[model samples]
Target: MIQPDYIFECSWEVCNKVGGIYTVLSTKARTLQQQFPDHILFIGPDLGHAGQAAEFDEDTTLYADWRRTTAAAGLPVRIGRWRVPGAPLVMLVDYRQLFSHKNELFYEMWESFGVDSSQAYGDYDESCIFAAATGRVIESFYRFHHLESQRVVAHFDEWMLGFGLLHLRKYTPRIATLFTTHATTIGRSIAGNNKPLYGYMSGYNGDGMAAELHVEAKHSVEKKAAHFADCFTTVSEITAVECRQLLDKAPDVVTPNGFEPDFVPTPDRYPARRADARQRLLRAASALYGQTFDSDDTFLVSISGRYEYRNKGIDVFIDAMNRLRTSADLPRAVVAFVLIPAWVYAPRADLKATLEHGAPTTAPLPTPFLTHWLHRMDDDRVSNFILHAGFNTTDGERLKIVFVPCYLDGRDGIFDTPYYDLLIGMDATLYPSYYEPWGYTPLESVAFGIPTVTTDLAGFGRWAQTVVSGRDITEGVAVVHRTDDNYAAVVNESAGALLSLMRCSDAERSTIAAHCQSLAARAEWERFITYYYTAFNHALTAAARRADA
Candidate 1:
């Protein structure tokens, strides 16, 4: 078996996430380990969610403690292990404990370290503390892992791991570091389409200046990661182009994201399942959303992902829905709209948070590890929410709204849980992000034999557009653009596309689902993992020749 000395990938969102990095790593870790031969180690800020989990073996226990020394330096600390499927040397780094040390670290860095938390790391707030703490953690990892080096490759998923890449590169020249920015800070900030909302000045805290500077520092990290890492890549070619223009650093490779075929429950494998899924979901969603629909007035429309507003196209999609309902004179269809938007905050934003847990909120986590973050958490309440969708439907609305804007960390992922249950049942998906480095839902939807309607902006949509035989693409994976002057037209077209999909009888949608199944069979892990191997080999071989030179 071929193996690399080490594989390092970092995400600020780990089990306790604030963004998409968590989703990519957690979903791909199992296959990643097999491709690289069980040498992948997660570098992250655990926050508090990672305590002692059942996944840790004795040897990995040492690795857990090694990570803990820095992450929980100031707080009450414990160790946790990630239970990945194929990866043998998987380690989950928890950052919850960082909350306690933030203030002290910033104070010390200012007074003794001669570093102002505001200038680069943060300015007496989240930006400062988080960056500083994360930087320190990466610094420590090198000390711990550098001495026992073999052939190694480290990739930082986003800027959160920027400082660590530099720290390692200075001392361990042999270790190849690849930095991947799924989306650039400048790209997202500009795509935000509004300055004041996610502006450089406006921030999680009311302290405006720190937010502004944090934006700058984030851009700075992009340069550092791209310039410093041996090889760099983005999730899709579109994203790579964006990165190159934004950072003036062209990605060496464009590694597209691949979903697990069998896990997605595509249409072909489950020929008879679509009708059953739709019926089951209609009953559940009907009771969940509390709308009355006669037998004929039912349609299932869905859009799920973090709430990036302009980036994810939720508002445009909503407006499109309004048009679809208002413009045409059709029989009242039960359009069950299910929205799974991530990052549950942003009240002032047009796409304001909607949908209270109509059902009893599932009994909270054993002790609510997220007590502090609950208000800001775009957390997935799947267990309680699955039950929310479990109600009986005499008449289901054509639309079902499901909003999941946080980290679906556990087994309840869209691919893993009833989330797919909801997908298998929906007539169409609404994902119109302004800045999606890579969108996985469209791929998943197509796999379920349900065609998707996404935008060219996302990595998947951009790539799928180029694929010659999309008979392999899931049933309804249609790509839409958000740049149109008339979003209403965009919406109309998108909705019309979705309606066209529904126009197909149940069997036709299933046939489309079969095409998606064939598509997934080709998107196997066989070729995907080879890139990591190739990247590591390139880095190692390049480093070896450099030494001889």
Candidate 2:
């Protein structure tokens, strides 16, 4: 097997928990550590206030010489260990300095690589500036250590880091470059705009769609990066199709995301941990609704991810919950939580008071469905949907929907528990994603022995189909067939899947939970990390050929 002496992985989410990419890198770090040890390094944009970044443990002594030289040469960075499983070495670059050279960098990219920066807006400039800075940091370190002759790999994740890969390829030609697009800019935009992405994928022109969706600059950079990188990869086969059609480049590898099981409780302690999680979740729901829940009888379900109403199927999840409420055959009282983070203003004062002290009144709180107060309460889609759907915590209702607008970082006032802690309590999870590159929520749910319902539209859901047959929750995951025009059918199928889970006998439920764990075991980093090694080898061989040429 071919191996790089040093690997440098760059992503916007490194040490900064924004999305699923954070989970990917953080979890994969330990496995990569086992293979590469101190030879691997992660690069990320500094969060400005170092004190605010709790995940980074700065170690000034580890790279003092390199830091001093890099700082002297105009690039300042914080050398540290990410507070993840492996505690891998990391460099948080202060990319703000590069903003001054934004135009120069963009022009250089355009002139050299044909990366069109003329129509860039929003986060394009910020992302590219940081990406270019990462390139410079890698170049500085490579030169500082005289690693030109050594086998080295520079891996950049997502379109946000596309410029970094291009920069690295241009400046550090000896370093093998790999670029991974979790989801194509144009593909995501097409889905987000309510277009029939899958149905008309082949007919869609990447550049034309980019112009129509006002994502030309991001598409341009992403497409060029895919073509320029020595090895280009994506998270899943579904996304590989999107990359081929939308980006005009087939991925060299489909590097699926994998979970690190270190955080999951041991078999001996899982029961107690699960019980505690259930208690906390029920307590929060009870506080929000001012009604105590029978822990044994209540079925807990959740839908969480980025608050993309249509793309993440937040709308479908809400509609499905609404459908469940009207079902006469509903086996148990359902408490469905919308755990997506939004512009949370603060924890609900009344909910907090109720959780701290006993509920003064048994009646539902003013907005019985919300656990936290959103900044724009009136305009928030989830809040508006709950209101319009007439969802309520009525005394005899069969279903209750609670929207948690805050990130569950264990300090979000209410739960005081991390996301994974609460995740273990879920009886089932639903992620009927319309455009997920790789759905992590469903995967995480199953990893915790929770049966999940996702749709065929998701990359993870498709992967699940390969692992197990049939669309049954008993098989650990139920991948409902979803299409652009099948919103109603998807909602009904999701509701049916939840009902099926709720109706499972104790023995059957236990078996299903075991199945969930068994399925998740197949997706561990130990198995999936080989694809990354394959990508590294491809990049290295390509780089060698470039050198020869």
Candidate 3:
């Protein structure tokens, strides 16, 4: 392993916690921290997202001299430690000042690397400015620290930070650069815009599709960075294919995302948390539909992530629930929760009042399925789909669909629990994604000892097939075969997976859950981090060769 003396990792999700990249970096920080100590640093935007930085324990005095020096140089940064399990050093850069030079930076990017910024719109300019500012911070830090002789690796993540990789390549040629694209811009755009991505993936010209999807500026920068970086990497084998087809640059390495096992509660503490979570979830469901449910008899299942109706398979999940509702063979009552965030106005006051009353409810609340009220209730895809499926009135339904349309960060008022706390209580989890790159939610579900159902189209599902040597939901994960046109079949298979799980005896369920957890053990960072080390070595060796030349 060619480890660096200093490693600088940059991402738009360092402390912001918007998406899966946040999970990837935060979970892997401790292992890296153990090797590098304070030499490893993470750089992120200082957007001051209210209480989002709770995990960031700022220590201005730790890097006082460098902070003053960078301040003098007009690059404001707050030095801190990410209060995750690893507590690695973190630097949140204030990139607002760089917005003034956005045009000049874009012009230079176009001139030096052919990153087309002409068609940039919306948050593109903001993200580009942040990326440029990240480059500036690293350049300043490297010089101030006077580490020209030391081997350094700078890893930039996703398309959001692609411009920063270019900035590093042009300005800091000695620094080994690795760029990892979790998903290609044009590929996700094609899937989101209702195009057949998998079927037409081979024939689609990335540049042509970028123009067709109006993602030229983003696609150009990502492609250029992939070409310029010392090493180009992605998170999964499936996404590597997308990079080859859509980004037009096959990755040098595939660093599948890994999780820290420490995040899971200890076996001693598990029972209480699991019971409390189940009670809270059951109580909330009871209050929503005004129906009392037996905690032991109720089977809790959920699908949680960013709300993508087709892409994340909300439509298919609802369809399966529709099938489960009418299936007479189900032995127990199942409560399905859609724990995805939407444009919510606030938590429902009536539900809060009902829960606080601590009384069993037999009268349903108005718009009972949703835990939170959305600003665009009429336009919300999940709610509209469930409504169309006749789930608006689920009082009589055995398979109850409850929509918790808010971030479950232990503060959603109803659950008052983080995602993993509730996730551990689930009997089964479903993430039938149609356009998933790595499928972290399903992976996470299995890690928590919950049998999960996912589609082969997902990278995690494909990986699970290799690990278990076959497709069996009973082996802790059910990898359903999905394609661009197998919508109905996928739905039927997903519903069948749930039905089979419900039919399992207690002994069978225990065996299956244990198997799922064992599979998750195979995906731990201890096993998966080697790929990253290989990628790091690739970048460093290439950079060394270039320096010698």
What local distance difference test score does each model get? 0.55, 0.90, 0.88
Clashing residue pairs, backbone N/CA/C < 3 A, model 3: none
Model 2 C-alpha lDDT per residue in residues 459-480, reported as the tens digit of each score: 8999999989747889999999
Candidate 1 lDDT over 486-522, as tens digits, reads 4666677676776666566667866776666565555
TM-scores, each model vs. reference: 0.72, 0.98, 0.98
For candidate 3, lDDT tens digit of each residue in 1-549?
Answer: 788899999999898777789899999999899878999999999887333544598996877887887787667899889978889999998888777887899999999988898998877988888888889889888888888999899999987888788888888989999999988998889888888989888999999999999999999989998999899998888888899988879999998988888888888998898898898898898898888888988888899888777889988999999888888787788899999989989889999998999988888888888899999789888988888888755555787889999888888877888888899889999899999989899989988888999988888988999988536788999998889999999889998888888888989988997898899999999889899889989999999999899
Model number with the top lDDT? 2
Poorly placed runs, candidate 3 (over 4 Å): 49-54, 392-395
Off by over 4 Å in 1: 1-3, 49-81, 94-149, 194-214, 266-281, 288-297, 327-332, 342-418, 468-475, 481-486, 545-549
Name the weakest run of 10 consecutive residues (lDDT summed) in model 3. 46-55
Q: Could you report the Cα RMSD, in angstroms, for every candidate shown?
A: 8.6, 1.2, 1.3
Residue pairs in candidate 2 whose N, alpha carbon or C atoms collide under 3 angstroms = none
lDDT of 3 at 207: 98
